[model samples]
Target: MLSEKMIEQLNEQIKYELFSGHYYISMAAYCASKDLEGFANFFIIQEQEERFHAMKFFHYINEQGGDVKIIGLDQPKTDFKSLEEVFDLAWRHEQFVTKRIHKLMDFAIEERDHATQSFLKWYIDEQVEEESTMLSLLRKIQLVGGKGHGILMLDGELAKRQFTPPAA
Candidate 1:
């Protein structure tokens, strides 16, 4: 059974994951407005991935005999100055999430909850991938001077991205 504190933290993480999905949706809207359909598709895929992540926590909490709480999320930023700005924000968001996950891992270790620690290892690895992906995209945008034909090519590449949920 999960301690109350652990349960509370897990519930909060669920909220954060859902908020990430919402934020990605806002980014997608911004991309679509700029006629960057590929970029929009990429964000949409990211949103789906966030939702999947939230569900994983939800299921894990339930399996561990913890109450799953549905909580409110703050509104996400909807405006973007440019594609580069959007990617920069995404990379920063991923870093924020990585810190949160590490904090959770620290708590689990402090509590000596081995099962929770083991479960969180997957999320830790996932955050690494998330951060790398966002940073890579940001770098690519910068390399292309953030405009023109290169941007279109990048968009096309992003459009081909599809969400494939990892094995649990």
Candidate 2:
């Protein structure tokens, strides 16, 4: 059974994940408005991934005999002046998520919840990949600049992105 403190923290994390999904969807809308179809597609996939992440936590909490609480999500920004800005925000958000995951891991360790700790190990590793991927995209965006041809090339590259849901 999860302690009340752990359940509270996990609920907060779930809200954050839900917010991430909303944020990505907002980004997708912004991309679509800007006529960057590929970029929009990327964020649409990201939104789905974020939803999956939240569901994983939801199911895990229930599996551990903890209460699963639904929380309201904050609105995400839907406007971006440039692709660089969009990608920069994404990279920063991933870094933020990494820190959040680390905090959860620390909490689990402090409570000596071995099962929670073991479960969180996957998230810790996943956050690393998440941050790395966003950072890589940011670097590529920096290289491309905000010019038309550059943006087109980046869009083409983004079009190749495919979402593969994480294994159960």
Candidate 3:
């Protein structure tokens, strides 16, 4: 069974994940408006991934005999000044998520919640990949530097991204 505090924290994380999905979808819409289909596809995949993450937490909490509480999600930004800005925000968000996952792991250790700790290990690894992918994209964007052809090439690369959920 999950401790009340842990349950609360998990619920909060669920909300954050849902908000991440919303944020990515908004980014995808912005990219579509800018005629960056590849970028839009990338964010579309990201949005699906975030939704999966939230559902994973939801299922885990219920499996642990905890009630899944729904929390309010803040509105996500619908517009970005440039692709650089979008990638910057995405990288920053990944960093934030990594911190949050680390905190959850710390709490699990302190509470001797071995099950939760084991489950969180997957998330820990996932965050690493998430940050790495975003940083790589950011670097590519930086190298491209507003060149139309370079941007198109980068977009094509991003469109190739496919989400494979980690096997539990």
Q: Using TM-score as the measure, which candidate wins?
A: 1
Q: TM-score, each model? A: 0.99, 0.95, 0.95
Give the alpha carbon lDDT tens digit for every residue of 119-168 in model 2.
Answer: 88988888888888878877887886666687888888888888898875
lDDT by residue for model 1 (1-168), tens? 899999999999999999999999999999999999999999999999999999999999999999999999999998799999999999999999999999999999999999999999999999999999999999999999999999999999999999999888
Per-residue lDDT of 51 in model 3 = 89
Mind sharing the TM-score for model 2? Answer: 0.95
| Candidate 3 weakest lDDT stretch, 10 residues | 159-168
How much is the lDDT of residue 32 in candidate 3?
94
Model 1, residue 63: displacement in angstroms?
Answer: 0.3
Stretches of candidate 2 exceeding 4 Å from the true structure: none
The whole-model lDDT of each prediction reads 0.97, 0.89, 0.90
